[model samples]
Target: MPVVLSLNVAQKTAPADHARVGATGIDKRPVDGPLRVSPPGAKGTAGSGVAGDSIADWNAHGGDYQAVYGYAREDLDWWQSELGTELGAGQFGENLTTQGIDHTNALVGEHWRIGTALLEVTGPRIPCRTFAEFLGQRGWVKRFTQAARPGAYFRVLEEGLVGPGDEITVVHRPGHDVTVELFFRAVTTEAALLPRLLAAGDSVPPEVVELVHRRSAVELDS
Candidate 1:
């Protein structure tokens, strides 16, 4: 049984990364007690939950498909060793820091029941310029890409409260071979794998499915 090691929310602050020119809510910090969890709503709409946790970039973040993000403590440990620094929970801007779960390997559409909320894995967190700037590491984006240990993003299925130490149980897993790592690879570096994403059915994000079909069509035409 996986568990939430810490529940975190973003701190509204001036843009610390090149990804945004205005305020960015990427500097997440651990919160005490239970935190409300729900859909961030559709794009162009404000994200739900705590007031300050709102998505700073509507064009690239937020929406029902990416309501919450999770990162594994194991992966953070790995990065700590590489960077020779200590990383607290939520350093990666994840809402939940989890323990004892293979986050990168979890299958898309896998459901995790935490507290009273049900969340389904949507996809992997792709590193962006903002994340690179947040860490202040040169070539961080390329390094992160090469590592390919992207954490997972989930969509809220049942709105409820979640807090640290909540037990995480996999209540459902869609029958599919498309793990988060595989999907990340398909999106980032493996064009051939795009066609294979169809095996995951609707488990894949609608936009991702459309992108896969578009890429597949272009390949066929060429």
Candidate 2:
């Protein structure tokens, strides 16, 4: 029984500087059901554009998915142990910290209720260079990729509102043998497992499916 341990939201207030690789300022705030997303504006805040309903945008620029941010139950402990601070000291970036659910094992298409908001786990995040830069550690992205427990991303199926301390309950879990962790490993390392993952089609997203197909094709051609 997974539950939402905490919730957090932040706004980037300043441009990146030499000393800082990401937004220079972050303002944590509260939000309710029906999250909104628009194209970034001149002021840097997201403007009313297309609603952010895609995994690519949620994971882009810095793993900025609001839904997945709810899975950061471990961040607080990790930050305190390693960085000697809490999540809001401008070191670790995440929103909606959670607990109880094994996010890596969440099946794609599975839906969960976080307070009044409905979120569907769509896919696992693909780690990128920005992750490495954020930690000031070279190759950190590769290390995280290799670890293969990339957290889940969600789509707002029934928009409402969510906030810190919201409870999360699984509403649906598709039958799939492949876990998000396994899918990530297959994609980044043991590509031979791609076929098996794809066979569990219900649990994998189209982009992941295409990526596997492309890699397998290349391997066969080579």
Return the TM-score for candidate 2, rounded to 2 decimals: 0.69
Candidate 1's residue-wise lDDT over 21-88, tens digit each? 56567788998858878877774565534334756786677778778889999999999999999999
Off by over 4 Å in 1: 48-52
Global lDDT of model 2: 0.54
List runs of model 2 lying over 4 Å from the truth: 17-68, 75-92, 200-203
Per-residue error at 85 for model 2, in Å? 6.0
**RMSD (CA, Å), each prediction:** 1.6, 5.7
> TM-scores of all models?
0.94, 0.69
**Candidate 2 on 1-222: residue-level lDDT in tens?**
555554444543344442234443223344442344222232122321213322222223222223344345564455456545454422333445577777777766677887676777756666555445546666767766765556666655665656555677888877776666666677787878878777565345555678778988898899
